[model samples]
Target: MPRPVRRFHPLLFVSACAVVLAACASERTLTPEQYEQRLPALEARAEANPSNAAALRDLGEAYAQTGAYRQAENVLQRAEAAAPDDPKTLYYLGVSKEGLEQPDAALTVFARYRDLPPRSRFQQLMAGRHGWLLRALLRDELAALVAAEDSLTAEGVTEAIAVFPLTYQGQDSLYRPLGRGLSEMLTVDLASVEGLRVVERLRLQTLLDELALTQNAAFDAETVPRLGRLLRSGRVVGGVLDVQNEQLRTDVALWDWPSEPLPGLSSRQAGLAELFALEKEIVFDLLVQLGIELAPAEREALARVPTRDLQAFLAYSRGLLEEDAGRFVEAAAFYSQAVRLDPGFAEAAQKNQEAQAMAEVAGGVDMALAAPRRSARPPGGTSLVHNRLTLLNQNLGAHVVPGDEAREPTADVPLDPLGAEPIPDPPPPPAGGN
Candidate 1:
C-alpha cells in the first residue's frame, strides 16, 4: 500500500505568505552606504551627457535615495525641460517634490503623469503612483474617476481658484463659524461666476491632510503658493474677520494664487444684526477684483441668502466644514439642525439629504481613502461592470420594484402570421402522409 499523502491547508499557506511579505516590507531595502557608492557612477554618466533625460533621471533618483532632495529637484527639473513629455522624469520629479515637503507641486506632477498613456509594465508603475496621489488629493472624486469619468477635466473657461478657510482673529470660540462659514460662502459665490470653477473644499482639505495642518494653521501667505499649485488654481481668496462694537468687519484679500497680491482689500462692515448680507457684498467685490462682471439677474441670484436666521446659517456653515472633513453623518446632523431651526431652509434641507446619501454610500472617510480609483483597474473594466448592471436594472423594468406594471411598455412581438393564416392545414397533411 502507498503511504498516505499529506493534504494542503489554505490557512497555513496564507499565514506563511503574509509573514514573509511583512518581513520584506519591514526590512530596509537599501543601505545609505550602498546608495553613496552607486551615486558617483550615475553622476559621471549624467555629467557626460547633460542633455540625456534618461541618464539625468537615473542620477536624480540616486540623489533622492541618498536624501539629497535639493540636488534631485535641481537635476530633475533640467531633465524635465529636456524631455518635456517623459513619464520617468515626471515621476522622479514628483518624488523629489514630496521629499522636500512640497506636496502641492508633487500633486501637480503626479496629475500630469497620470494622464500619460503607458507602453510597458514600468510605465504602468508610474500610473499607479498617480492613482495613489489621486486618492490623497481628490477623495470625493475618486469613485467617479474609478467609474471611468472625471468631473475635473473640463477645459479652462477662464481660471481656477482655491479659497482658503477664513481667519478669525477674535478670541471667542462661539464665533468659529466665521472661519469656515465665510470661506464656504465665498466659494459658493465665486463658483456661480460663469467662467470660474472653485476648487472643492474637500480637495483643499486633502491638501491640508498631507501637510498635517491643524485647523488653526492650515492657510497662510507662505502656504498659498503650494496650495495654488496643488489645486491648479490661478487665484486664491483669504480673509480676516473681526468684531467691534457688535458690528462685523471683514477684510478680504485676493492673491495671484502664489504670493503676489492683486490690488487692494475688499472691506465691508455690517451690523451683526444684518450679517446675512455681508457674504453677498464680499462676493461682489471679489468678482470685481477678478474682472468677472455678472449680469443683473446673475448678481441677484447670487445675492439671495440661504437663511436669515443667524444660528441656522451658522449651523449650515458648520455642516459644510464637517462635510469637507469627510464626516458625513455629523454633517448631516448639522444640516438637520439648520433645517429644523428654519424649516424653509431649502439649501440646508438639500445638503442634509445629500450628506445622508453619502453616509450610506461610504461608511466613513477610511472607505473613501481605500475605495477603487480609476487607475486601479484596466481601462474600461469598471465601467463595463457599471454599464452591464445599469442595463440589467433597466431591463428588469419598474415591475421589479413593486410598482404598477401598466406604466411600463410591453415588448412588441411580431404579428403571428401562422395564427392568422393556417396554410389550409398544410394541404391535408400531404394527402394522408404520402
Candidate 2:
C-alpha cells in the first residue's frame, strides 16, 4: 500500500496456471456408464485426429466395458496397429480378445505386453489376468482332447501314451525342496509303468541361484531354452507358481512339447487349474502324461492329497524316504511327527500304520535279546511255553540257558543269525553343493 508494488505478479500467474492444469489432469469423474458413453466421443476424436493412439485405445476400453466385444476388438486392433510398440494398446487388444472368447489370440497379445519395457501397474494387472485366463482355456481344451482320446482307446483305435512330468527349473534350491520331492515321487511312480518313460530335466534351483549370484542372467536365452526344452516333449506338462500378496497363483500347461517338428497340440494351451484345483490338475495331468487312464477310484485317490500346507507334505516326504530305506524305527518316528503335524494326511496315516507294526516287531526282538537267561542249574521239567521261548531266544541269536555241566561256545562262533549288514551313512551331499 505504501509504494503500490506491482512486483513479480508474473510468478503468481504461472503458479495459478499450473494448479489449473493439474486439476484438469487429476479429474476422474467418468463412471462406467459415463465411460461407455464416452466411446462415441473418443471415436470421433480419433477420426478427427487419426494419429491419436490414446483416443483409439480409450474408445476400445469403453466399448469393451460396455460388452461391445466386436467393436472393442476392432478399435483395439486398430490402436495396436497404429502404436505397434505401445504396451497399453496391446494390453487392450488382449482384453478385447479375451472378451470375444478368442483366448489363443488374447494370449499372444498379452505375451507381447509381458515383453514390453517400463511395465506399469496397469500392465502387470492385465498380464496376471491374462495368464489366468490362458491357463483356464488351455485346461478346458485339453480335457476335451483327453476325453476324445479315451473314446478312441475304447474303440481300440490307437494306444495313447500321456507323459506328465512336473518339469521345472530351480528344483535343487532349498526354497523349492517340496517341488523336487514331488517331482521325484512323480518320477518314481511313473517309472513303474511299462511302455512309458518320464522325461526328466535338471532341477533349476542351482542354475537360477548361480545366475542370481553372477547377475548375468538374461531372460531371453536362459528362460527360452528352459521352456523350449520342456515343450520338446510330444506332450509336455508344466506349471508356474508366483507369489503375489502372500498367496500363490499357479499356471499349469499341458500340451504338445514340440521339438524340430511341432506336434498337433502345439498351437493350443490346454489343461489349467488354480490354487487347490491346480494341485489336482497337476497330479491328474501326470497320470495323463504317463498314458495311465484315471478310473473313478484312482481319481478319488488323486483328489485326496492335500495342497495348502506344503510344510506337512514335506514332513510326509521325509517319512516316506525313511520308510523306503527300511529304517523302521526311524521311519516310525518321522511318520509320527508327520501325523502330529497333519492329522488329515491319508498317505502319512497309511505309512504310519506300517511303521508302527515294524517298530513293534523290532521292539519285541530287542526285548527278547535283553531278557535275563535262567541260572545254569535250572529246576527240572520246564513248561512247553518256556522251552519254546528259550528256543525262540536262541533262534534270534540270544544266549540260551545252559546246564551246569555245559561249556560256553568258542569266541570265534558267529552268534548273529539275522546276518544284518552295517548300515551305511546317507549318501554324501550331492556334488557341487547340496
Error of 2 at 208 (Å): 29
Per-residue C-alpha lDDT of model 1 across residues 155-221, encoded as one tens digit per residue: 3323678887877777655566667877877787788789888887767766676566655564565
Candidate 2 wrongly placed segments (more than 4 Å): 1-31, 151-181, 184-434
Off by over 4 Å in 1: 1-158, 215-219, 258-264, 364-434
Model 1 clashing residue pairs (backbone): none
Q: All candidates: CA RMSD in angstroms? A: 22.8, 36.2
Candidate with best TM-score? 1
The TM-score measured for candidate 2 stands at: 0.34
| Residue 266 miss distance in model 2 (angstroms) | 34
Instruction: Give lDDT: candidate 1, residue 416.
Output: 18
Cα-based lDDT for every prediction? 0.58, 0.42
lDDT for predicted candidate 1 compared with the true structure: 0.58
Quickly count the clashes in candidate 2. Answer: 16
